[model samples]
Structures are given as structure tokens and as C-alpha cells.
Target chain A: MWPPGPRGQPRRVAPTIMNDTLLTVENLKTYFFTERGVFKSVDDVSFTVPRGKTVGIVGESGSGKSVTALSILRLVSAPGKIVGGRVMVSCRGVLQYAPTGTVDLLTLEESEMRRFRGGKIAMIFQEPMTSLNPVFTIGDQIEEAVALHQKELNEAQRWEQVLEVLRLVRIPDPERAARSYPHELSGGMRQRAMIAIALGCRPEILIADEPTTALDVTVQAQVLELLRELRERLGMSLILITHDLGVVAEQADEVIVMYAGKIVEQGTVRQIFSHPRHPYTRALLEALPTFHTTGRLRTIPGSVPSLAALPRGCSFQERCDRVQQRCREEDPELMVMGEGQVARCFFPEL
Target chain B: MGVYLFKRLLLIIPTFLGITLITFLIIQMAPGSPVSLKIQQMGGEGIRTETVSKAVIEQTKKLYGLDQPIHVQYLQWIKRLATFNFGDSYKDHRPVLTKIREALPVTLLLNFISIFLIYLISIPLGIFSALKSRTLLDQAVTVILFILYSLPSFWVAMILIIYLGGGEYLNLFPVAGISSQGVGELTRWGQFGNVLWHLVLPIIVLTYGGFAFLARLSRAQLLEVIRQDYIRTARAKGLSESAVILKHALRNSLIPLITLSGTLLPAMIGGSVVVEQIFSIPGMGKLGFEAVLSRDYPTVMAIAAIEALLTLVGILVSDLMYVWVDPRISFEGM
Candidate 1:
């Protein structure tokens, strides 16, 4: 829900005393129909993000975190289809369904999707170097994005808008940076340029899929801070998908833990950190190398199960220390563990 | 850049000399001699009073400086070639370089026109096929191009002559010769137009195969560029598909295509020998072929030297262009 207002300040409305759900995804299942048969990449993933907040999705590689983001954007490559799901976005006093309703993104014709993408929702890709076209100057790219969505603006106005967004992303020497090509910019500058392009339109939702994974630790911290400041200042919803727990701890208001193509845990930042019910989530927390830890650090035993041959019960049963016979016989569904917290497990640990 | 040009220029010396040496040795060692062939021709005409005696042939060779040792002849030829002198033709008693120079412009014109036509037709065709890959248009183009690429140039030339030459229903093009009768004695513009008209068939036949090859290569390279993550990024920025293709994908794809074009440049100058023969165009290939048949060592050696120089120039130009298109490339490494 992008409200037409001044650039940086959040608008005030009558306090409804109820959470405003900006996006609601239900039973989202995305599959890749390959020669080897269908591989379920995102199975029954469900999450809800209230307006003006951030949702952090955390998982190891191949854990369906990135696929869920791509599925939401309907950018999954060919042979991979969003098989079953309902992604609803409430924007400008209208409800839009993803795969089944009016303007279903999964089935929307490419021309129609073009109008919504980068206009209503935008994405910041993982590798900034490969994401920006090397031939175009950063300014030209940002200006093009602005003009594509806002065709009514004149060239001078569009350029002004580009400069405004570039400054908003806190890029120094915005004027100079605009004229420089991608190869001329440092890694951090390129990443910031990507963010400027993503936020140029002031879309309803910004999906950042591991935006800082390719940056060094110092740059990662700076990028995370910029994202937090931008999110708060713009009052725009953010879906931050990453496997780094440090990133989540620093910025996420809410968290979703996915394992083997399924969301095994979801909760507020405090709920997830204070008492993680899922064994996988607990193991993930323990695996984090803290300053106190000495000798060999703890690691989750065994690798992630292949999507084609997931365990029958809990997907994490094979790696769970507290696994029982029942945990292996039946798959668990998300059960309430605390206020606004859900974990899928046979026996929730306290 | 000056250093690069200097290096390229330095390379031409050995290349020209090497070509001259190879062509001379090959022609000399071949089973026939120009004196013997001329005597045979006179004998066929009933004008021969005596066979070509070995002593006369040896005397003729001495007069022409061919009696010198191979190394001495090679050194003398190089010295003359350094001053743009190819000595004299033994058969016609004309300057060998002058004859080659007179024929070269005609060959260059035909080859240039053909290459230009090929690029004009092939680039768009290649982009269209790549954009609509696996569709009916792509399939049709692929099949047609495959046929064209596999077809012999000479056969295609003969077919064009039969269909488009005078006396046929089409009668749209000249049958043979660089100019129409009496036009050779006219103004330069008139003579140029006349030569161009006669050149049409040979140029078309020579162009078809290379057009098919370049088109396929361009389409494949464009497809690869289109698959890059940067293209997706451009699309995600809400740029139109046309802008995505033209501004982003095509520019990057041209780097490879430019390299391929450089490789194709010499082919245009070399002129397809078989095609030239079939169409009866007075190009370098036709001259080279005649020199081979008549055992004209000087003419053959001059044409080979020119060809080697043109090829080296083409390659050098292509390498320089690569740096322009992609700044990341360094010619020093090459």
C-alpha cells in the first residue's frame, strides 16, 4: 500500500487498532517440472506481513527462501511454475490475488506483469555487479526506471527524480556517480545503485533477495543500516530474504525460518530469538559462532534433505536430537507456540 | 594505439614474403611450365615449327632472371616488392603488379558489395530468429540458412546465370564481362555502373553462404547475451522488451559478432574462386586461377602477397575493434 504523500514522512490516519495486512500468502507451492520429474522448491509456504513492517526469511542454501521471494515476484525461470498458491496484496483500496484472482501474477500476461513489476513491487537482486548493466551509467539506469513507470514526467523532472532517489539511498557524489558505469563503481556503490533503482518508484513492497550477501562485512553493515533507515523513512513494506542470522537480528521486525522447501517457524523477532520452538531453528541459533565459543563450533548434523526425497514426518527429523517414532511417522503442521509465533513440530520444546 | 599499429605494420613484412615464397615454390614445383604450355597451345593451332628445346627454355629463363639460384631470386623479388614492384609478367610482358592492381579494384568492389549485402540481410534475420527461437519463423530460417550454407557457391552462380542472364525470361542481369560493349571506352561513371551491373550475380552467389553463417552465429551469440542476469535486471527495471533487447542485449552481443566480422573480412577480399569462374567476373580469384593454369609465377606470387597482407590487416582491425566494443579486453594480451 503506497500512500500518495510527501517523500519521507509516514502519514497519519485514524488509529484503527487493528493490524493492516499488506501481503498474505497462503499454501504457496512452487515446483520445477524438470526432466527428472517435478521438484517442489517452495511447498506450502505461508506468511503475512502487515503494512510498514519488515519480514526476514532465513534459511541455509537450498532452503526455499529465495524461491519464495521469486515466486512472489513471478520471476521464477521456465520449467519452474507456481503450481498452487494465493498471494494477495492490498494496495490503494484494492485486493489483488497472485495466482487465482483478478490480475493473478502467476498467470498474468507478461505485458500486464510489466505494469505491476517495478511500479507496484520491485526487487533488489543478490549480486549487484551482475545485476546492473555494465554498459549503462547508474544515473541513466535509475532515470530509465523512473520514466518507465511515470511516463507523464518530462525528461528534466525524471532526472530530478533520479537525483532525489540517488540521494535518498545516501550515495555520495550522486551527480558524479550517475554518469559512471557499473564497472567504474566500487562493489558497495554498485549495491547502493541497485537499491536506488529498486526504490526509485517508491513501490508498495520491496523484495530484497540477499542484497548484501556479496558485499564485505563492513559494507554489509552499512547496507543493512541504509535499508533500515529507508524502510522506516518511506513507510514501505520490505521482504528481506537472506540466510544470514546476523542480518535478521539487525533489521527484521518479524522472522520466518524455512527448511527443505517448507516454512518450519514464524514469529516476531523477540519470539524467535528468545524461545525458538523448532529444533532446526534452535540448532541454527546454537550454530552461530559467538565470541565465547571455543574449539569446534556446533553444526547441524547431516546435510539438508533433497526436495525430491524429503522425510515423511518432520523435514528436520533426521537432524533433530529429540526425534521420536511419532516425529518420523507423521508430518507436523504449524501449531501456535506463543503470542504470534508458530512452529511445525510434533513436540514443541517448552 | 600507435604502438599497436606499428606492431601490425611490422608483421606485414614476413607475411608478404612468406606468401610470395610459398606460391613461387608451389608453382615452380607443379608438373607444368609456362613455356611448355605455350608451346602445346601453338602446337594445337598447327603453328609449331619445332618443339620447345631445353636450351631455348634455359636461355629464356636466364633472360627473365629465373636462372638465378632460388635464394638469389627470392632476395631480388623481396627487394623489388619492397618498392611495390612485382617485376614483369613473363607471358604478357606487362608489369605483374600493374596487372594485379588493375584487376584488384574490380575484385574489391564485388567483394565489398557482397559483404555489405550479406551484413544487411543477415543481422536482422539473425536477431529475428533469436527473438522468436523455436517458433515457425525460426525453424524456417534455420532450414533455409542451412541449405544456403551447404550449397556450393559455383553451383549457385551457374543457376543464377541460367535464370537471370540475357536470353532468359528474367533477363535482368549481365551474362559475363566487367562492362557492356563500348562502355569500357566511356566515362568513369558509365564504366563503373556497367561493371556494377555485371557484378550482381557473382556478388549474390558469393554472399549467400557467408550470410547464412554470420546470421546463425549472430543469433546464437544474441541468445546467450539475452540469457545473462543483466538482461533480467534491465527487464525488471520496467524497461520495454524492445529497449531491453536493443539497448542492453544487442550492444553486448555485438562484441562477439564484431570479432566474427573481422574474421569474415578477408573472405570478402579473397573472392570465391569457383564463384568467380562460374560468373566470369575478372576478380583476384579469376586472375589467380588463370595464373595457376598458365603457370604465371610472378602474377600468382603477387596475388598471394596481396592476399596475405589483406588478411593480416583484417585481423588487426578486428582486434582493435574488440577493444572499442569491450573496454575490458586488452590487445596486449592477444
Candidate 2:
């Protein structure tokens, strides 16, 4: 048993994952040192992905969903730094920090982090059309992910593994699909190829960052179904980052709604959809054009606040329909409510 | 691919004919054929030709076969060319093909070696400078390459010769030609080294502008490519920094470099007139220049035909290179 730390201190990294929580992100902050001063791109955002389940991080463009995913991988590029907090990945033998098996990804050396990435946790990006290298065959690109991480596999076995992944993603004739270039395939097939590449290493955590945004609607449904089935079959923790609530509702077991670089609400998919608490979350649900509603789509009053010049208290304060005096003075923390649900609000709408 | 090649080969015939025809016409339009020049240079008896005898002038034209009309002469030239005879140089009374065979390889060697070095050095520098954009190293590369690019190659050649090949300085390499006097007596390897030793100054001059231009182009191209979404995907795949760059980013950046191939061969052979003249290396550029000044019509036409053919082939090779560099490009039509 590991010795307990001093009392009252916020545990930056929960020593290791139990059977349930596969990944824990604690008080995560990622800042960009730009000419326009320090931009808090992902400030005070934290979430956990339960094992064998999907966690959807939903946000509009520039709401830090992608940045948060990048931060978890410690891939925040130059001029951007993870200035605070920890991303505790479940350290198997692949990413052995200690015999206790926990690695604070933020603290891992770049080389160490590299071993964790693509080996233990791989990311499939948005823009499937562009994410795959144009010059390489889809099979070679998939095999590359395996080659870079799975050093134990021989060339023949790696080829087999790549073909196997292609088949897993329902790519018909895995041999031909592997030989096809990114431009040679349709957008949907390219997304499937991208998933094949992501799954090539048999990663414990697979981050699908807007994986279907550039795909067609029908293809989108198919791709989402494929991801859900893959997660169930492999028992891999999945993080689905998207701007589509419909995607979250269908695929996510847990959902985190982010606005202006901070999580505004967190709950089960049903709770967030049926009993949405935060004003921003409620506005987002109302804005969705549904077959159930006949009138014009209800638009949110104003645009999401820019992270550079966020207002004095709540980021949503300028646009909130029920803005209070206390909401003007200070930002509220996520207050826990029913069954692991929490929302950042001075007055919960529910 | 075969069809494309056949189509390209079909294009070259008319292109060759057009180039040869234009060169022949341009030379004919100018006053004085090679016979007339030879006659005048034969001295005082020829210039005041009536005194010497009119029959002698007529005999002179007959002797050189110069009395034929331009169209008849073109037919004869083409007939000879079909038999792989490029005709004899009127200036030297030597076969044009023989002269080209002797001189063209020197230019090709110099240009090819310089080009090889240019690509070898420039590509890595370009990648490094791009990866370090907005940093001191990038700015330094920009300033240095700009300065090198701005300095005229002719001037650079002269400066290199004076500093590296003159008595006042090092005299480390031969200032002219491509081999020492006893090159033939030396062993084969020694012969090559001797020629390379003589080539140092000219090679340096030839490579300076090329490497600078290529590096700047590659930097611009790589900067654009590495910013693409796929490049991010490459990094996110947990590739090492070098792999992200050299493997993932390099091929896309090289697409622009392939565009330069259409001009590379002809530019190497034809554009080296100054360097060849300054070094007196006896390459095609100098041969073409001397052929032009002496009104050696056959030699000039032969050089022009070869240059035009090379340019067309260069274009074909460029297309092939595109198919190789990017899988998105294929020779087969959709």
C-alpha cells in the first residue's frame, strides 16, 4: 500500500487508477504565452474517463475541447504550456512510472511521454480528409502507428495487425483499403482509416477529437456506431470531443459541456439532456433544431466569450438570461448535485 | 504510364523540328554563310574577287556545297540527322556529334555534381530553418541565404578564383579547365581526383546560387506543409520530432521541388555560359557560344536541338517525379 499524503491538500494526481476510472485529469490548466499576454486556453478544467465507457467533451469552436484533448497528451505546442495540474494515465507496463503504476503525464519527460503516446493512449484527429498522410497508403500509415509503438511485432505481424484493424473498422477488403491513399478513399472511408490507425496499437485510451465533423451525416452515424462497438469490444476508455450534442446524446455515457475554456456543466448524458442545469447548457439544448420543435431554432443571446478577454465573473454572464449580482462578482465552482452531476452556476436553472 | 510516355514522345518530334527550323532560319537570315566567311578570311585575293577570278569564287561555293537553297539544305540536313549524323562543324571541319560527344559530358558532370550537392545541403537546411521559424536560427539562415543569393555568381566565381586559386592567396585548386596536363598518365582514380581538383572553383560558383534558391524555396514549402492538419496528426501519433518532420512533412514539401525539374537539365547545360567562359572548361555552354560567334550553323543548330530535347524530357521527368512523390498523382487518367 502507498503512504497517504498530508491532509487537506488537493491531490494533483490520484496515485493510480482503480478498476473503474481509467484516466483522471485534475485542475488542468493550459496557457498560451502569446503577444496578447497569457491566454488561459484550458483553465481549471478537470474530468475523468471511466473504464470501458465513452466521455464526450462537448463545446463550440474555440471552447478548448481540442486543446483539452491535446493537453492530456502533453502535445500543447510552442507558445502554449501546461502551466498547472496533472493528467494521470493508468500506467500499465507500457508506461511504468513505478511498481505502483501511475504516471502524471504532465511531469513525464518528453521521451517518456512519447512512449505513453501511441502506445498506451492514441489520438484520432478531426479532418479525417487531411489527418492521414497523403503520400502513404492507408495500410502503411496504420502500420506506422504500430511500428512506432509495437516494437515487439515483426514486419509480417505488423502488416497483419494493420489489416486486422482495417477490418475491425468495417473497411471492406482490408488489403485494398490499406493500399489506398487518403485522397483515394471517400471522406467516410478516410475516417475509418484514421480509426484503424488509432486502434493499431491497441491503446487503452483513444481520444476521438471531432472524428466525424468532416464526414457526411449517414457516414457520421455509421462511424459513431463503429466507435461505440469498438469501445465495447475492446473495453477501451474513449474520449469523444465534438460540437454535436446529438453525437454526445447517442454515444456518451458521461458528458462535459465546456464554454470559454472552462467546463460549465458535467453529468450523465440523460441528466445533461433532460435536466440541464447551467444557463449555457440550457441555451445550447434549446438552440438545437429538433423534429419535435416546429418554430425557428432558438438562438443563444450572444456568442461564446473570447478566452482572451473573459468577463469579470462568469464567462456566460454577458449572455445569461438570469444573470445575478453574485454571478457578476465571481465565478462559481462546479457544485455537485444528484448522482455525480455538477454545474458551475450561481443559480441552477433546474 | 506507357500511354503518357508515348504521348510525350510524340510531342518531341514536332518540338525538335520547330527548334531546328527556327535556329536554321535565324542563322540564314544573318549575312554571310560559312563559305563566304572562309573565302573572305582566305586573304586579299578573295575580298577583291574579280581580280583573282570569278570561277574561283564559284568553285569555292561548289567545294563547300553552299550553292543549295535554304529549303533544299534543310532537307539534306534532316536526311543526315536521320542517319545520326549532325553534320560537320564548318569552323573546325570536325563532326558536330563528335564535338558534342567530347564537350557535353564535362558540362553534364559539373552540373550534375553541383546539383547533387545543392539538394544534399539545401534540403536539410531548409527543414531546419522552417522548424525554427521566428527564431534566431531562422532569421540567420534568411539573412545569409539572401546575401548569398544577391551576390552575382560571376562575381562569386571571380572572388573564389582570386582567393582560393591565385598566387596572392591559397592557390589550392586549379583556376581553369577540368584536368591537369598529365591526367591521362595518372591511374583512373587519380584522373578523376585530378579532374575534381580542377573543378573545385567552378563547382563552388555553380552550386552557390542553386543551393540558396532551393533552400529558400524548400523553407517556404516546408513551412506551409508542417502547418497542415495531417502534420499535427503525425505528431499526435507520438512520432519523434525528426520523424514528424523528415518522414511526414518532407515528402509534401518536396512537391514544389519536383516542379523545378522541368527546367533543371536545360538550365544546367545552357545557363552555364558565364561559368564555363570564366573557367574555360570547354563545356556545351562555351561550345554553343563559340559556335554562334563563328557562324558555325551546324554546331549551333545541333546544340539548340539537344537543349530543346532536354527541356521536353525534363518536363516529362517532372511529371513522373510528381507521380512518385505524391500518391495522389497518378499517370493514369481517371
Candidate 3:
């Protein structure tokens, strides 16, 4: 049971009393009911974000990685409903306001859900150019987020909080950057401002949905480094959703490889990279061109199937190099191959 | 901005000249002169038709300065315009300035009221429809607005007159003119009410099309704006839906409406010609209609010049308003 408090007042968890698992998502299914057909964007996704650690979700486009993040936050809009899910967020973490027990975010009322969003858990989107409101200055937008979550703060205090977050995000000139519009800043700085907005409430969990995807190569590295530094310093769990495997290798402790709206493989970063289990994961790892890769980069045989019209058995059977009769006949459930490693394949590599 | 406005004002001189010069030349080439028209009227009145001979026509033409070369007449008219002199109306020989001044207020009052109503009603209508877009209520509103938009104003005015005015069915409102005959005897407020009552049908006819069109435009613009990424950002910030739409989306959606307001200037000054005629209101539209019918060159030219100036001013105002709503545009470079 949560603390017996009315709305807008979340139970406070002490900073030092940390929970090992900050978030657990169970059987989450978000489907988009469009005119053409129902898109099973995030079908039965299950994951957890441990405190002060990074969980990377990697997949090609339309693989439901981004939708999983949105479902956790309940930010999916019209036509895309979270049909079934339990996004249980543990309050006893480094967060100051998370309740003493886990709360199901999906079932919370809109007002309560609003309090959780940008308060206990925040998100930074991919397109920094468009993420910040163009009409508002950086400081104003951040101040708005702060004012919404931190109700007791006065205007001056909210402004101070904005400047503090800007400084925390390593903006060179906080005062100048605060006064400038989104268009006035570079892509990197805009992303930093976006991060500052997320950091406005000192969230325990930060969801970076392709945070560095829109930046230059150097800027991408810088942003990822900043995120890494911010996570470590703030003791916040991160859900890094991206298609770049190199970023996962550099930044993630755990990796989830998704295909056709389902997780094909999930394991420790080293375990999944060094010894991939599922054929799709193996193909994805093989496709990555390392320094020792002698020939041309390996390409996956086929693309992901449309979620509306997936094959009868395994969704990846058409794309699998090691496909067989069993794979074509029956769908495979996730099987535990080793400690902390799960693969969905009828004939997983030994 | 000041420098830009000064330059715009200076540019108006040439534009004014071009408008007046072309109008004067077209009038000269037109067939109906005051003298021939007068002669025809005299013949129709059963007066001394044979006595209105070539000598009498020549004297009348010379008196009215129509016998001069076209270029000389244009130059003379331009010279008079420099002194703010619009000469006299050929219909009644009244000073064009006095006639326009009398008619200008009525047109301005009616148009300003219509414009005010259009904005007041359509903006909320647009925002509501957009918020409820694709719902049955929104679809119904759309159908109703489209019907209103498609119906011609004159036809609507006639229907309104027959149904709501002093027709056989209702007789609730006055059928013609902007005021009752005994309005001067009433208190000021009473006089105002009488005028407004008489203006109801005409104003309705004038404003229905405008509001319907503007509501649709604002709905479309707001829809596009609410779909933009920044609106999503606002929502992600934990602001309520109202705050996101009213605060974030409304201002961004107003650019199209502001553009339409600029183009509305000519219509504002010219007044609704058919509506004014149907109502028999002594507004600028009715005045200009009579002037053109009687070939009153001075009155027509004066009205054209004033409408042109207001149109230029309207464009400038809307541009300045754009800067107010959206800081991205500035007049400095222009």
C-alpha cells in the first residue's frame, strides 16, 4: 500500500534507502488501432531497470523498443493504447519522493500519472531540435517542468532550480543558454537543455529514447558521455533505447535485442555480444563490423515482418539463417539458456 | 520598424497615383458623360427635348471640365488630390468629401462590429471543433459551417428579410435602412438600439460567411499546430490538456487567421455591397454603388483611394501582429 496521502503528494523515499530494482515491466502490450490494421508495437515486453544501472534496448525500426519506453511512461497517445501491462516502479530508491512500495503506473489516475511523469521518472526524446518548445526560452521550459512537480518552489526558486539543472547538464553559459530559444542553440546544446528539463525534478529513472540519434558523430559521443556521467552522478537508472550497437557496448550493462515486436534475446552485454543465443541476435552481432571482421559487413537475410501480418510460427523465420522445419512449424517461447540469459528460438545455437 | 513604416508610407504615394490615374482614364473612355445623361433624363421627363441641342451639350461639357484632353483632366484631378480635394459628385453636385465622410462612419461601424463578432465566435468555435475533431459533434459542426459558407450572403439576406424582418411571417425587425424614421427624437441609447435593431439582418448576412470561413481556417491551422512536436513536448511536461492546447497551440495557430485579417481590409472599407443594397443602408457600399451607376467619377475615385490606403495599412498591421504572436519574424531585415 502507498502512503495514505491525497493526490499531488507522492510518498517520500529517503535518498540513502535504495531499492535494488528501480522498475519492473511485466507482460506489457501496447497496440495501435489504426485504420489499416492493429500494430502490435510492444507485445509482451518484460524488463527491469535496476538502480544506478543502464539497460539498453536495441532494435531496428518498428521493433517496439521506443514504444516500450512510451508505454512505461503512459505517454502513448490516441489510437495507441496500452492494452495490458504492469509498469511497477519501486519508490524506495535514490528518489526523494517515490513511495516506500512499488506503484503500478498504468492504473494511476491521469492527475497522479502526471505527477509521476517529470517528477519521479522523466524522458528525453530523440529530436532535440523539436523537443523543446520553440516559443519558450530554455529556462522558461525547464522552469515550467520544475513548477509543475515542485509545487512549493517560488518563481525565483524555480528559476534557480532551472539554472542548477542547466549547470548539471554542463551547459557552458547557463545564463545565456537559459535566455536563448531552442533555435538559438546548437543540436548538442538543445539536447543538453532537454536533459536539464528531464533533470528538473531529480527523477530516479531517465528514459533516453534515441537521445543521440539526431546529433553529429562527435556530438553523439559527447551526449552519450554526458548521459553516462549524469546517471552516475545522480544515481539514476537509465533506459537507453537506440539502434546503435556500438553505443550499447560502450554504455549499457544489460542489452535487449528486439525483433518484430518481441524480444528475441536479452542478456548481459558481454554475454550477448560474445555468445549470442538466438539466430536473430547472432545475425545482428555478425552484422556488426568490428576491426577483426575480415570480409564485407554481414547483412541480415531479410527485414522485419509487418506486425499486422507476421508469419504463423517464428516472426524471424524468414530472416533466420539457421531456420529449420521446427522453427517454421511452431512459435518459440523465451527459454532460459543460462544465468541471466533468455533466448526465443527453437534451435538456439549451442 | 519605424524606418520600415516611413518607407511604406512614402511608397503609398506612387501606388495612389497609379490607382487614381487608371481610374480617371477608364472613366474618360466610358460612354456615359454627365451632359449626355442629363440630356437623356430631360427627354425622358418630357421637358424641352429638342432644345437640349449640341450647343447646350457643349456648354454643359465645358462647365463640367469634361471637354478637356484626357491627360489634362487626369493632371488636374491629381493636382486637386494634392490639396485633399475630391471635387463634387456628378449626381447631386455635393462635395465628394462630405458624402464619403457621412457614409464612412456607417460602413466602419458595421464592418468593425462584424469583424469583432467573427473573431469572438469563430476562434472559440475553431478551437472547440479542433479539440473535438473527428467526433460526431465536430462532424456536425463542420457540416453546419460548410452549409453556412456555401450559401450566398445575398440569398441568405433575402431569406432573413422575408422570415425575420417586416415580412408576412415574423415582422420582428425593420425591413430597410440603418435607423427608424423617428430615431432622432429618442434618447441616445434608444437611438443606438434602434440603429442596431435595423442593422441585425444585414450584419448577420455580412458576418455568417466570414465567421464560417474563418472557423474552418482556424480549425485547420490549430490542428496542424497541435500535431507539431512542441505540443507533444508540452504534454510530456505534465501540463494538462487545456494548458497544452490553450497556451502552447493557440498562439502558433493564429498566424493564418492574422493573414486573413489583413486581406479583409478592402472588404471592411468597401462594405458588403449587396447587403447594404438589400437593407438600403446609407453605407459606403451603397454610396459607391450609386456613384458608379451615375458615373460620379470623383466619388468613385475618393472611395477607391481610401480603400487602397486602408488595405496597405491593414497589411502593415497584420505584419506587426505576426511579430507579436511569433518572435521568429522581425521587420528589421525587410
- Tell me the tens digit of each residue's lDDT in model 2 across A1-350: 11112344423344556766778899999988988877888999999998888999998898999999999998788788999998887654443322344658887667667776777788999889878889889988999888887777999999999999999999999999988889989999999998898898778889999989988899999999999999999889899999999999999999999998999999999999999999899999998878899979998877877678888898889999999899999988999867979999989986
Report lDDT per candidate: 0.82, 0.86, 0.86
Give one digit per residue, the lDDT tens place, for model 3 in A1-350.
12425646654323332348888899999999999899999989898888899999999999999889888888888899999979887766424544467777887778767777777788999999877777788998899889887888898999999999999999998999999988889999999999999999678889999999999999999999999999999999899999999999999999999998899899999988888999888888788888899978989977889898888899999988788898888989999989999999989998
Task: Please identify model 3 stretches exceeding 4 Å from their true place.
Answer: A1-19, A93-98, A292-295, B48-50
Every candidate's DockQ is: 0.54, 0.72, 0.60
Clashing pairs in 2: none
DockQ of 3: 0.60
* CAPRI grade, predicted model 1: medium
TM-score of 2: 0.93
What lDDT tens digits, residue by residue, belong to model 1 across residues A225-290? 898899899888899999888789878999999999999999999989889999999989998889
Error of 1 at A285 (Å): 1.3
Better of 1 and 3 by TM-score: 3
Superposed Cα RMSD, model 1: 5.0
Which pairs, if any, clash in model 1?
A: none
**In candidate 2, how many clashes are counted?**
0
